[model samples]
Target chain A: MMEQVRVVLDHAGDISPISSEEYLRIGGYQGLKKALEATETIIDTIKASGLRGRGGAGFPTGLKLSFTANTQADQKYIVCNADEGEPGTHKDRIIMVEIPHRLFEGMAIAAVAVGASQGYIYLRAEYPYVATILEQALADARRQGLIGSNIMGSGVDFDIQLFIGAGSYVCGEETALLDSMEGKRGEPRFKPPFPGVQGLWGRPTIINNVETLSNLPAIMVKGPKWFRSMGTERCPGTKLFTLCGNIAHPGVYEFPVGTTIRTLFEEVGGGCPRGKKLMAVQTGGASGNIIPASLLDTPMDIDACAEAGATFGAGDLMFMDEDSCLLDVLENLTEFFEEESCGKCTPCREGNTQLLRLIREFRNGTAQEGDLNLLLELSNVMRGGCLCGLGQSSPNPILSVLRFYPDLFVENSYRKGDLAYA
Target chain B: MTTREEQLCVLEEVAAIAAKWRDRPDMLIPVLHEVQTIAGNCIPKEVAMTVAREMRIPLAQIYSAATFYSFFSLEKRGKVLIRLCRTAPCHVKGTKETLSAFEQALGIKAGETTPDGLFTLEICECIGACDVSPAALVDDTVYGHLTPDKVRELVASLQETEGSR
Candidate 1:
């Protein structure tokens, strides 16, 4: 039996039982209703759950709310980063479209707990379906009195709005997302006066990942311990992994945090398709580095992945089978960064573009010896110098590919005698 | 597979959504979604501009909203739009090869709609149906485990099926 809980998409979607009542029947806002009564206890529950931010850096969700709760800002904003901009990640969008209402419930309760009146879902342009789902959910929430002034008549007023983002991958960064929400280009703004301190219209804004927001109501009802009881110590609850690549099963997978990477491959995904060997896995979209085959036994727990030099950013797992060339794979990711770079910073704009050219030249077997060294040097520069992750983590793919499979980068190209990742 | 009349009906439906929430500047997101679903894709400057005038919102604001969301298409798509997943997961499953095959069969490149208004080839990021490696969505139907051979068969069947319809 599939133990699936579509909290957001309670009754499927627009074609069927697409109403709050239908959602309610399936135990939907029971969490929110429970949350209103247990307002003060919400953060502790989340902290006990050991739930961490799914969007890149795995910061504890409970700690984020705790910081906001203690902050002296007169106005706090509950911002949901729904911009599912990660190349391989689509779990958030799936959850959003399937059940926008659940996310709204999560957002609303979060607003009440954090004492925020305004909420925004900052979605990316790629996911047009989400905007519709979210809009409909907000309407439903308003009509049901789950949103708007005094939600559920609990005297907690919150207005959730949808804010669309331009095609800038950097906006996935919390600060940059805030900047974009402020009617500016989606560029990464520096930290210090972080969004938790000064965000949106310069108030204390707690930007939560869509998945983070989606998980809120559950934490409220279940208690932090109930949530914590599911996963490993320190990394509790379920982390939704958007599995892609040459795997047999490629879709959104919800599993306990410490599930081994091998289990995700052999069991959940049914292993690599076409009998191909799993060479390396790119965990957490582009920012996360490739976990080599030697590390396939590595568990996907937050700290576990982080210890291996990969932040499980939004849990986007991309599996690269043996047959695919590593150089092309690295170049492919670089081109996306180049196309979606936003060009606000010099290192990313110029460096990523040049990186693409250099990679192409190297692939074409025309790379000078110095060019290889130059590529390495340029990657380091782009990583440190760029204002955002698009540029900062740009070298991850190259470095991972280079370290794990140096043979993929022969004197140039795949060597004539090289075996096909046997 | 809608008639021009049905298409126009969708526009009317969109217009109604726009009219209903004209007072709330916040209703822009919903209004756009309904309109886009009706319009097939959001194109024609007039669609947004008309909303701007009727809703009394700035054109800049409408355009900004339209451009920000990925669903709003600014131009006409071919009758059958074939967007293959090109993101990391899809890439792992040889999306490049699938795209190459699509371009090969269509005699066109990425983002190009065929001359007869039949097929448009695009490389979209992982459509999030990663449970099926190397997926391609033809309008709403998702095709997984795509190969160069599958591409040829799909293009052939789509054209034939369109003719029969």
Candidate 2:
């Protein structure tokens, strides 16, 4: 069946549309106004909506908000996690570029709901233009009385700040993001305190992804039933999939969570770029496993993604067609993890170094018979022992790639040239 | 000692930035970028010390941040700082050719400054001008799609402009 391309864009077909103007026009602040007007309704709405954390873990967003709200602290903070350093994952970048104001409004609304006064968007420095736009939007939001004290005369006060990561991938982990924001190195902190309890200057905080926040307004405005009706029971609402690589049309696709990846590619993204068939689909960016083209009909719903052993992770859907080498993709993603690892824990820091060395060996063809086994073993050690999400998630690519592409291993071995896009 | 006018200039700039973005607190990088573009490449020690006095950000932090990235030039720079790409894509295209051309043109190594201070040459990570294959930045201005002859002429153009100024 043919389907219309869901316009996740701030304003469809408007070239110069600013996210702020377009967002406000599309019943944007109506949610914030509603939240401010009925404080109790905010928590109830999120709980009823069933919106899972799109940042890969799929935790219940309302539950996290409610838990943080219940925590007894002098102050609580809201952080929009935008440190999207994953290779194929440019999804968060789209949200930041198109509707930063919407994210801000969502944060402000969430902040008020949780009795918090301030929010932070920890964006990576790779998004220089997004950073500039966010700064501009923030200033405008402040001037409009949507952010500052007594917003809209509802007496709900809130403000937002942005911090840029030096392109560290691990900072996407909620706790690590909290640490980096506190003026320390961009390494992941231990999580018994959990950002929800002791975050940002040892205060309670709620860290939600940019996409997760964008959904807040919709959930609040249209009600949870409308959101739930789109996706499955556990997974609700239309997700924005940042489609890229050898596909015929490489861009973001906003569709219901349960939409099969094939339908998304065939109908929404206009089928694989050129006539090339799909080789693999990488959901959840670099951390998630790569599904082979044989599984093109695999539904991209949260349950299916989990059964396929990948998380939604900021919803970065990377499609690779035939004629592309998995070894090269692994190498590209590896190089990113190596450079972006914060080096706080031994497993992630040293394990990543060892993994890269081994991956390089496989590419160099200097790999021994047990080289794959050894890589798998190292991944196991890193996955279980790492301090934070950075080290733990590092094994995902190594583990997933070896399982899917055994032929790419034996033929190419290890070679530096394989990493390049030929 | 730095003059009072210099002190007041740093004071007003820091104060203005603090007043504007004190809430955001994350605009510090862009703020510091504009500050360093003033006469010297870095926030001079005196200026750093002054910002420290007003904003409570330490002089050490200011120096540490300025030194962390290659973009923030700490020491006095030559009129032209020729930072060429040294990463994989550029290296694959033979950045050595560019290095050799600069060596012959300036009679100095890639990291050395000419005795006359007209040019300072160095290798850098990718500056995102991969379209140029071998590219360079001269004083924050990008020169893409460069070759050996272009490097030589680029130096010549710089010398000509310096003379005119």
Candidate 3:
């Protein structure tokens, strides 16, 4: 049995999330104090910790911070990507609602490292209640001198404001998030000049995920070597996996990055409910690839999952029992991309529309023999041509289904008398 | 339909919200949120124009921002908007039946509002409550683990509260 190893969720249930004193009692903001004392080494220490972004893309945190730190700007900014819009992922919400001070302290550490004075928490519109909790936490932090000007008499003036995102899934994309923060339509900006160099009103900005930032205090308090002791050498630290769908224990579980899918399913999730057999699992969120039950031993790390032709996006594990239809699942996933395409680029807008049509044909038992190839061909086009990550990864579900369960398409389409076009 | 005076009152309320945010172009979404609240759950044309004029932004830009997000509705919605989760996690956990239950209880489909302006039924992509599959957002609060009986009871309670009010 693989028990949870809580690192980011260190003070989740024990502390009052709104109280800064409770957080302080448990040694919160000590990381910021340490970072302040040795400001120059903060970035280097983070780099050595081997922490990566927890917002789907596993970009190295220290590398991202260095980009903004190196850039010469009059006023740089730090933005926390709290827009937890991934379909099955709510780990960031848990971190924000449970241990908001940890997130604030983390942001303050980053702000001090990068010489940034302003910070923004781009919270999603759906979690309005969570926003209130964060708002109170921010006020308490401000009152306690944890945030605001001259934090702990360190002469580092830093403050954070919460910006509520109107409901757009694409806004979860960092560039789109910056555009939305500037009060424009939440369309993703072209990246050549990434947000690290020119972002949020053409100023150098660093946007870190809520979970990634939440890990900073722990990493700062415990040295880099201690941080790297638990997880794999390349991908260090624990991940909060949001387990849901067909499982007995469907909630957030904190485990090391290299944990296997089988341990997650059988030991942690207690297997499928009502003694049903697990047929398939979709790691990551809606945009992640689906893996068949046969490959249950694949380790849940960034490099390992990539080697297994999957992504450990935001660490979401959505299980499916034998009774579930993969075709029906594909249709739901396709429709999501279709509705959320944003229409800024032709490949994503038109590609998702046509992809949904093709998937629907298979679902309705009217798919032609050549339609499957057409689906794969279009997915490749979108993957290569789309402007942002949303469009680029929209076809992940279809591609994975084609890779693992190509027989599902054939079986669903060959139903007797239902094949109108055949 | 609102009278001209009532529309003016809504415009006045929207102007205050715009001013509160300093009429900055970057504060358009926040301003629109307040405008939508005052305009009875939708940003009607006059309210949009009021915001555009107050914020000194192009009406086209305001409309683009409003239409881009699913949260901001251009059309009027019910007093209690029920946004059901339509993602795969919820779908596999029987959200289709939960959706049907909501439709049956409200006497309307997914995109319609009750005749009395009491409730609006809509399907949203995800609210990240998959742990409690078959989840829904009744206004801003989330209700999870829904069933047909639960849906009926929730609708009845909502209607009863509105009746008492």
Candidate 4:
């Protein structure tokens, strides 16, 4: 296996996250300087790097920039999606805390590439501490002439400010984030007039994930070929996986894109606390599908994981042992989705509650075998009929369990006594 | 209970905050955040009305936006807000036991505040501290690797801090 690659986490522990001087000393703004020298070719360099978004959706970063650049507008905006609410995903928090200036620099480069003048970091409210660190980092950069009017004397004016989410998980969706920034009930808008065409006060906008933007500076400095050489051909460069749950070690680790479930779990995660036997592994967070031990050899590539009935979303790898009951876990996840569904659409608002009720009945030992079919039908409806990603992906956990551990649902259905599992 | 004069003062404060973003009508969330923070963790009805009037938006819109978010509580919260992680990662690591310990120490359940109004225990999604499973947030400070005893000790420390004040 490849050694732990630090492409995304290069400056995490070496220097204080808020220290502008420390970040600059380690060649922090080199990429932004390079981009400033030749602003027009920056998009081409990014396109050549083959960097997809580090967010759950692996869209090409260069293609997104080109759309906004091509659009004609009196004003435009660049939004950094820092609302990392996906359960089991915390790598963005690590990036925001350890190397915040990297994010600022990346945003600056993106502004220059897309010809945008202003930017915003849409931070999640849960991370108030990280917000302060980021605010301090922005203050330090502004003081040093790294941000604000005519940065680095490159004659390009760009400014960025932080906007906090109001405890809405749906706000992590790009349009929903835009709505939340506009001070409305965080709900997703219709597509086609996508954010690239009309966003953030009806101006052309480009929304990039925090980790995705964090890569821009480095990709510029090391060159695209150097980045392409690190990971698999399809998904280039190292991906940060937040490894946690029922393991010997639980923290964020950066691994190559094609690392197998076995290596990520057994080798790096220390293999499911002693003698427990890794029963299951959940990837991509609550919205991601499951990878049973039978499929432990499946690669973490997006297409490969999709073929295995799972998604490589945000690289949230969670391990579970024999002692943990999948039924209880499903109930916990279902309840979370129901509470966070935003109630804008019928499918997500109603379907999530129905799913939670069904799972609770099963856990209470009063469920009928027919309820399983009902649960399946409802999940399909939500997946197809929901308006946004939150509703569409909310049923992923149940569907993954149904795909992998069918017997767990079968054995629990219509059972009488001795249902004392927690 | 706050006096009529105090309520009017809060409305004035809300109006003042709303004036900064009146031209930028899209800045509704930040404006409510400031009002809630100033109004002791809950968005008072009077303050919401002032914000709506100043922003030229409907009161219903303000209420809908405020109540839509879990972070913006419509009811009054205690001095310290305790957000416990209830995600699967923390659940498997014995979060139920830790939660029970907190419930016992606080003399109330997870969604309720203590009788003295010093603490409010809430079950939240992962706060991104899964590395230390059974992690919790006490007013923005994260405490991880918690045990039942540790929870009691934490409550005692908070109680002591409150007593000295």
Candidate 5:
């Protein structure tokens, strides 16, 4: 019985999320106060806590802040990636509705740590509701001397503004997010001039996930060792997982990083509604790999999930029942990739379209046996040649499903032209 | 209102929006958002042209930015835009049934507006509410864990609100 170790979600349901007074009653901004006392060691303290970015890519939070800190820029910016567009991942909205001040506090502290004066929260436009909540919370924080100049009389002048995304999933990518923030067509820029080097108006920027930012209050308040004790060595701290789909309890749940998928499905998620046997699980979003029931014992850590052939992207564990068809799931994922390709790179744009066509052909029983090999080759090409993570990781669902369930694809391949080829 | 008068009003609002973000080329999205917010439902051609002129951005760039995101609509939409989640999780858990319910209730298919111009139905991708499978967005309000019956009730409630108005 692994009880949920609530860290990021500490104040989620306990108080009125918009009220700064309620947040202060529960020890909010204490971390920022403590952080301002020794601003010099804030990044080092985060590094010592072993806090990794809760965003898809598990970059070290400390290292990202330090990069922006070291860069000699007159105007630096910190961005909180709230474009929660990844399918099956919705935990950030809970944070937005439950504890928006935590997000503001985290950004304010990051601003102090990295010497940034301005910050932006790039939120998804679909969640216009949460945007209102965040606005209210920002006002509440500002009124209480938490957001504006000389915050709590600490002489740190950091202000944050909310920017709603126009609805591109590619903007969830760090560089693409910066591009979207700049009012450009959201497209991924080439790396080496990473966001930390020359991001957001060609100034050094530190972009972190919404959940990643929310962790700072807890980590800063409690010492590094307290934060490190809960989760595994590499990925310390509890993770917020949006556990949904065909489960008795389909909601946000916080668990230590090393919790097994089996435990999550069986205990927390209640093992599929009405005791239906678990067929498959899509760990992470549509871009995440489809994990078979046999791999349920794998730890939910970033490295462990990668070893199990699924990157723990944004902590979305979508469980499916035995009655659900894998072909239908793959079709949905492929169509999503096709629609969200951004049309920037040829491999992703064309590869995702071709992949969707092949999946549809297979589903319609009009495929050849060679299409599987074609899908594999195309997946490899998209993975290698795509410009951004959107195109690069678009083929993950198809590849992972094919790896785990080859028979499903082969059985579905028996069509009108397949017998002629056979 | 006359078409020319409506166009003039849209231009006036667009100018105000552009002036707010003046000299900040990066604030185009927010400006476009505000323009749409003021204009309601869609960014008119006249408004977009005015934005282009005021912000010194090209018309092609403005159109591309508007068309890029699903939220920014160039064409007119109904007063209440209904975004239904048709992704895998929602699909498996009766999203098609919910869609059918909306179609039956509204007498229009997905992506089509009702004859009265009160509601528009559009299928959106997963909105991160898969936990509450079969979710929908009724003009920024998320309704999750829905069945066909709930969909009908939702439609009825909206109709009631519209009737009262």
Candidate 6:
């Protein structure tokens, strides 16, 4: 019987998200207050907490903050990646709609730690109503002098503005997000002078995801040791997992990292509905791996899932029942990648279209035996040569399905020369 | 097509919106969003030109952003644009049926606008309303937990509001 351990979502539904007074009543800006009091030690405290980015990458949050902090720059900025564009993931929407002040407080703490005087919340255009809610929350925080100049009577001045993205999925990648914020096409940029060193307007900018920033207020108020007390050694603190697809319970659930897939499926999600047998599960969003039901006991931590040849990307668990077809699922995911590829690099731009065509052939039962080898070759090229995460992980669903259920391909395909390649 | 005078009115409105953002090049997307809202859900050629000139941004950059994003439209749309979720969760939960229901109710297929200028049907990647699977966004509002009956009823209600208008 696994249950939700509410850390970031504390007082979620009970508090008025638009009212800073209610947030204060529940100890909202205490973390920002603590952060303002001890500005020099904030980065060290965050490092000790072992908090990682919740936006699928699992990068350490403290290290990212310290990079921008350590860099010498006249103008530093903190950008919150509220562009929650991942398929089957809606936890950030809930967090922003329920506990927006907590998110703002987290950003203020990060700004104080990194010496950034300005911040931006790059909200997605899909969630326009969520933007209105955040606007109200931001207004309330400003009214209390919590976000603007001289927060809590301290000399630290930091304020956040909302910038809405139109409808580009690639903008969820941090570099593309920065490019989009600059009012350009949402295409990713080359790294090495990463956003930590050279970001928005070529200034040192620290971009943290909505979920990652939402954890800061709690960590600062509760101390680093208390934050590290839960979860695994490498992956500390709770994670928000959104379960959907053929499951009885399909909503956001918060649990400590390292919770097994079996517990999330059976005990927490109540497994597939109507006594249907679970055939396969896709952990992470559209780019996540598709594993068979036999591997349900794998822990949902970053290191554990990576060790199991999967990723804990954005913590989205999508289940499929016996009635579902593996090839159809692969087609849907492949089509998504093809549509979302920014076309900046050749591998991602052309590779996704070819992959989609290949998957459709499999779905139509017209795929030849050699098409499997072609599919693998294309996926390898895309994974190895794509510019950003979108193209790199686009082949995950195909590869994972081939790994777990190779019998599906063999059973469904035709002999070579029986069907011509389209 | 709008007359030259009507185009001038739209250009003036766009210039005002661009000025509201201080004509900052970085505020191009926001300015275009407002212009799209005012110009009937799409950025017209004249309006884009006006934005480019007022915002001091290149026309290519404006078009790059407008076409890069799914929300921005180059052609005119209906008064109401229905963006249905076409992602995996919605697909697994029968969004196809809901989509067909919408197409049937509206007498137009996906990506087609009704002749009456009331509704436009299109598919979007995801709007993060998977919990209520089979969701569609009308304007800025999200309507989820949809069946064929719900889809028809929603269309009827929208048509009624338009008829009264």
What are the TM-scores, per candidate, against the unseen true structure?
0.81, 0.77, 0.98, 0.96, 0.97, 0.97
Considering the two chains of model 2, state its CAPRI-style docking category: incorrect
lDDT of 3 by residue, B1-165 (tens): 369899888889888787676658889888888789878899999888878887888899999999999999999898888999999889999998999999998899999999998788999988988888889988878898888888899989988998788
Question: Per-residue lDDT for A1-422 in model 3, tens only?
Answer: 57579889997889999999999999988999999999999999999999999998999999999999999989999999998988888889899889999999999999999999999999999998898999999999999999999999999899999999999999999999999999999899988799999999999999999999999999999989999998888899999998999999898989999999889989999999999999989988999999999989999999999999777999999999999988899899889988988899999999999999998988888887688788889999999999998889989988898888767777777764455433
For each candidate, the DockQ is 0.27, 0.13, 0.85, 0.81, 0.77, 0.86
TM-score of chain A of each: 0.91, 0.91, 0.98, 0.96, 0.97, 0.97
Q: In candidate 4, what are the lDDT values of residues A1-422, reduced to their tens digit?
A: 33688988896888998888999999999999999999999999999999999999999999999999999999999999999988888999999999999999999999999899999999999999999999999999988888898898888899889999878889999999999888788999989798998999899999999999999999999999999997778888889988888888888888888788888887888887876898888888888887688888988877788988878999888888988788898998888899889888999999999999988888777776478789899999999999999989888999899888777776775355533332
Sort order, lDDT high to low: 6, 3, 4, 5, 1, 2
Q: What digit string (tens of lDDT, one per residue) describes model 6 on residues A156-181? A: 88999999999989999999999999
Model 2, A212-302: lDDT tens per residue?
8878877778899888888888888778776655555656657788888778778767766568777777767667777787777777777
Which of the CAPRI classes, incorrect, acceptable, medium or high, describes model 3? high
lDDT (0 to 1) per candidate: 0.75, 0.70, 0.91, 0.88, 0.87, 0.91
Native contacts recovered by model 6: 0.79
Q: What interface RMSD does every candidate have?
A: 4.1, 6.6, 0.7, 1.0, 1.2, 0.6
Show the lowest summed lDDT stretch of 10 residues, model 5 chain B.
Answer: B1-10
- Interface DockQ of candidate 6: 0.86
Show the colliding residue pairs in model 5. none
| Tens-digit per-residue lDDT, A1-422, candidate 1 | 23533333335454322367767776778788887887897777777777788777778888888888888877899999887778788888777867677788888777777788999888876555566667776787789887888888888789888887644567778887876665444567777777877887788888988888888877776677677677788777787877777777777777777888888878887788788888888887865687787887878887788787655777777887888766777778877777777677899999989999988876776665567678789989988888877888888888767766665566454343423322
Docking quality band of candidate 1, CAPRI definitions: acceptable
- Local lDDT at A164 for model 3: 94
Q: Give lDDT: candidate 6, residue A159.
A: 93
* Docking model 4 quality class: high
Candidate 5 lDDT by residue in tens digits, A23-62:
9999999989988899998999999999999988999999
Interface residue Cα RMSD of candidate 3 after superposition: 0.7
